[model samples]
Target chain A: MKNLNRRDFLKTAALGAAAATLGTKSAKASEKLLSEDRLGVLVDTSVCVGCRHCEWACRLAHNMPSPALDYYSNPTVLKEFRRPDKTALTVVNEFENDKNPNLPIHVKIQCMHCDHPACVSACIVGALTKNEDGSVVWDDGKCIGCRYCMVACQFQIPTYDYDVSIDPHIRKCDFCTERRKEGQLPACVNICPNEALVFGKRSEILRIAKNRTKRKPDIYINHIYGESEIGGTSWVYIAGKDFNELKMPPLGKNPAPGISEAIQHGIFAYFVPPVTLYALLGTIMWVTKRRNESADKDKHDHHSDSHDHHSDSGRDPYRTSGHNTYRDSGHNTYRDSGLSTDKDTKGDNL
Target chain B: MKPAPVKHRFFTPGVIILAVLALNGLIFLAVRFISGLGAVTNLDNNTPWGLWIGVDVAAGVALAAGGFTSAALGHVIHREHYHAIVRPALLTALLGYTFVAFAVCVDIGRFYYIWHPLIMWNGNSALFEVGICVMIYMTVLYIEFLPIVTEKFMGKVNLPGFLETFNEPADKLLRMLNSGLSKTMFIFIIAGVVLSTLHQSSLGTLMVIAGQKMHPLWQTPVLPLLFLLSAIAVGFPMIIFESLIASRSFKMKPEMKILSRLGSMVAPILGVYLAVKIGDMFISDDFKYILKFDVPAWMFMAETGLIIIAFVLFLSKETTRSPGRLFLASSLVIAGVLLNRINNFIVAYKPLYDPVAYFPSFGEISVTVGCIALLVLIYRAVVIYFPVISHK
Candidate 1:
């Protein structure tokens, strides 16, 4: 039975190693191979009417304690910009267009669901994963609540359930994965009165966004906010004013994990660097030991010769007139005492 | 070289104060577990990691690097003169790591699921690498300490009544284990050094993914290399600091000759760390950010200035030769590294949207202080009972 268990353990270990190697390779190779039919939403801020019905719908759909529908009509809430938190999955904030103050822009904030997510790469326990449908989702059961995802997120979208004492989780918008599976649009998209949010395949939405900007150059901004930012996002945006004016961060086109992973993997590839480092340390230890051993032998020989002469004169070698001679010969005595004692005890064992 | 315990009173006013602080920290921890981290800490979504991670984990790990450095010098390299300091260094490291793990348990929200990293691997995450390395290294450290435990108890396992029969068998088993372990200790030493290198650098990699969130002064591509170099630079100094403090407290003559040699080794490593840091900054054009006269700029200047001072002090033979001067220089290096870590993890990091500033609460500060005090107390207790300090 013991032999059988040992064999099983070895087999499992070997298989685990192989799986780990293959998993990293596939993850790297699939960086740009996003699903062709991945879902996305294009938000046209120019057309948004600033009514926060989407926030109410999101709360209602997610089983959160939302206020009465009449309460959301109060524009005073928009006066103070708010972020999506544990209580709310999505929020709408008002940004006054500097070029035209009369026409204010309403921006909806939630998880961007990047194609190459930093949170997915930062989660130490594989709790977060970038789904094929362009949604960055998390598994609560596997999450250790390290909150590294919060730090890794370029958009800074994920929030923690700090209020809950037991089984706290990281909360964020999951792109309404359940609604999509049921052939229904996201709660926010379905509730938009002006069809400000258009949902479809990412490529189709990008095409439509380009066509709209090309057809009416005066109506839309020249750039799409999430077309390439952080390796693209499921939620794209087009606004009349600059994205900065709408409170969107200006991010580079490259994926957020690109540089960090590059350096990390470069050094640890095939575990070559670690193995080589260990070998180098061992070699240094061997060389230093040989040199020290020879030096100790020379010192021992010289000490023994001095001891014979001192004995002939009938005086203690470790003691002088009215003082300890060992204390005066600092380095030599310190070394000889420790080294000779070690030799007497564990020398043969080494 | 057999070691004997120093004779000192077990209880003192200082120990009483530490016990009070520890009790207070325990109460706060109990509240934290019952109510949540929100009750005790100022950590929010904008600042998920605070003083616990910055000080307790990062600084703790860096200070514990003394164990590997001293072990390499004394055992693997066979520098017999360094043998006196190795055991104490190991004990400090063991206690430091134990508290670091405890701090992680407190800091993590799902403390029960802390073992998930072992089964569910995310090799791409730098944190994953750190977690695995730390776990394995901690185990190796414990195994390395087994010989000490065996040495303390072998042939002296005196048990009363029901447990008397087990003593002989236990002693025999320990003798077998000790003989076996002594032959293979070099492997663990090599493994310890390798693991330390991997994780020490990986700690810096944890911040690299922050990219724009981190201030330009600290965010560079060669952060892993810099972290590794600084950790190596601080290793010997940490040993010297601990050795001097331990000797003074125990009323023993400090091993000045060997310690001065160790002090001499710190200069070259510190010089290399400075060169790499400056070279990386210049190459990345991050020096431009230093001209802004902002908080991050001033912090950067302070951190670098402290290290430069330590480097210069260590270069002088007179400074390295004096125990008092050496202790001061080593303290500066420790403070510089500690500040660098805190700045990288907290001060220099600016979340994009959140406007609320974060400062650790009183509960947080007390818990960190209490953990350090508890570690010192444990170190004292272990050295007093076990033969950790070499006999004069």
Candidate 2:
């Protein structure tokens, strides 16, 4: 029985090891997804006019609250790094490109809609889901409003509607899923007079971006902001200046969600191992119960047979002496220690 | 054994104080639910988690470590002498989880959707595991406590037909349930151990996923290991602390020998924990981050200092046995543990470009305090009424 217990322990440990390996593998598998015909946008800093038209159109299209700053305002909000809030669906921030300070690089900040979104993975209630079309959508009904998605989002795109006390919602740029589903351009794309924000099939967007960069080497930077950034955001950007100056993190091609998903699954995959362990433990407990009962019955029979000769024996000698020694060594060891005192007191003595 | 008649001796000053605290807490919770999180919390975009997660959930769980201690020794380690303490420990675990669930409700902005876990199951979510495990474990704990319920409440109904049921069949029912639960208890005990292990570690893991948002001092791969070890190290001591206070209030003798033995076990584990922490820092080459003159760095030092003080105090052979000294050490360990959790989840997590910082409002604090008070009241009510503390 002891050997069998050890073997079971080993099997469980082995299963745990296998589960961990499987978890890591699943994480890698999800990461290995390649999108060849992906659509993206390329924003060239050389041509941006710091127009708030895209922001206006985004708000109008999403039915979000208009910003306090009218479209004709001085565009001073562009000076600071600003993101789309609950009210504002998109915001254009101006970054001073050292290559051409006279022409301020206006970067439109919104949800990147990464190929693998952290928000989708972070949401335990299935409130957030990333579509194959690459648009990340939110289902408020399933949402616990935990705001974990907001916390997990690397770009800090998701915002909470804190004012809505009755039914709060997390607001984020959805890449204009409604517009795209209707085969129409995003509001921001449709309003871009300079052709600065382009929305198309991700594959075509990549092609156009590459073609533009190749044709005008001196005008545009060699990099496409979303082509491989953070495992490829749906909306791509073509930049004349460095992306970092525009507050774009130096993200890797590996999406933030993929690695996190891997780690999350790796840790939680141990769930199955425990259930199997519980079954084994239950069996052991059952067997022990039966053994204990049988042992008690045998002791009772032995006592009855020995009653004439050994009437002095107590009802439960096992409780008083035999088991008690092994039962509580911590207190018993401290109270009446054997190894420290007498060597001969080891014969099941209490 | 036939459960003795429950003695009702209310109007004690302790009960009154507890009652007042409970009332105050309820009012505070009302304010929290109505006024929104900003009205009563120090939470911000940078630090999404704060005092509630730190003290209420993390610290509360550690204090309830009695469950793990009793269950592990009695069930896993298979030392039958400590069996008497298991039920109380299980009770503490149940109450602690109940408080944690309440904290989650109040702390979460759209707490109404918390039921989303059961309806919308996301297999990949850590919070899903935490939510599901805690909920199920809470149920299992209550089920474990049912024998106590039967022994106490069922025996007192006094209806003629019901009274007849209590005589022979009731004894059999209790035995069958006890044996059945015992047969099933190992699974839940193991489940509790495993679930607590994962969630406690995941508390640290939750911060790790925050990436650059968290301070370097708190972020490390070994956080899971650290949190789990601390929970284990503090588990038995917390039990000792709770039992000591109960013994004092109930006018019973302290379980000195048991507590002393537990203390000795904890001291070595604390030493090992310290070694692992320092060794992890050294290996990661993140030791310099601890020296930085920043809030995260100072918080780290303070957390380490508290643990060290507790370890040193309890490490002594003489101090381990003294009930008062053991209590002090346990308090420090708990304080250090709480501080570590808070610093990691709240104070240390600083993201760039966050304009606002969060502080739990009076309402938030009230709700948290109230939840704790309720747990205490429940615990007191149980121990006073039931056979929680075994006879001398």
TM-score result, candidate 2? 0.84
lDDT of 2: 0.68
Best-fitting candidate, measured by TM-score? 1
DockQ (CA atoms), all models: 0.33, 0.23
What lDDT tens digits, residue by residue, belong to model 1 across residues B19-41? 88888888888888999999999
Q: Write the per-residue lDDT of candidate 2 for residues A1-350, one digit (tens) a residue.
A: 12113432232233245534554466566556534555556665567698778888888898876754365357667767776666787788888767767887888878888776778777878788877666788987788777777667777778775544457777888778888879888888888889887776788878888998889988787888888766678878888777776678666555555434444565666566556656665565556545545654554463342221211113334334533553456444523553221121111100
Error of 2 at A225 (Å): 3.3
Candidate 1: tens digits of C-alpha lDDT, residues A248-347: 9899776777666655665577698789999998898777766655644544554543331111111212223212333456547645654332322222
RMSD score of candidate 1 (Å): 8.2
> How many residue pairs clash in all the candidates, one count each?
0, 18
Report the error of model 1 at residue A201, Å: 0.6
Q: Candidate 2 residues B1-392, lDDT tens each?
A: 11222244545788778888889988866666776665566565455567787778767766676686577665655444455456667778888988888888876778887787988887666666667777777776777676566656444444476477566675666667766765565566677666676666555556555655667676665666687788887787778778788777767778786678778887888898898778767655677887676767888899999999999998798888788899999888878887887787677767555777656667657767777778888888877777565544
Where in model 2 is the C-alpha error above 4 Å?
Answer: A1-20, A31-35, A67-72, A79-81, A97-101, A207-223, A268-272, A279-350, B1-18, B44-46, B159-184
Mark the 10 consecutive residues where model 2 chain A has the least summed lDDT: A341-350
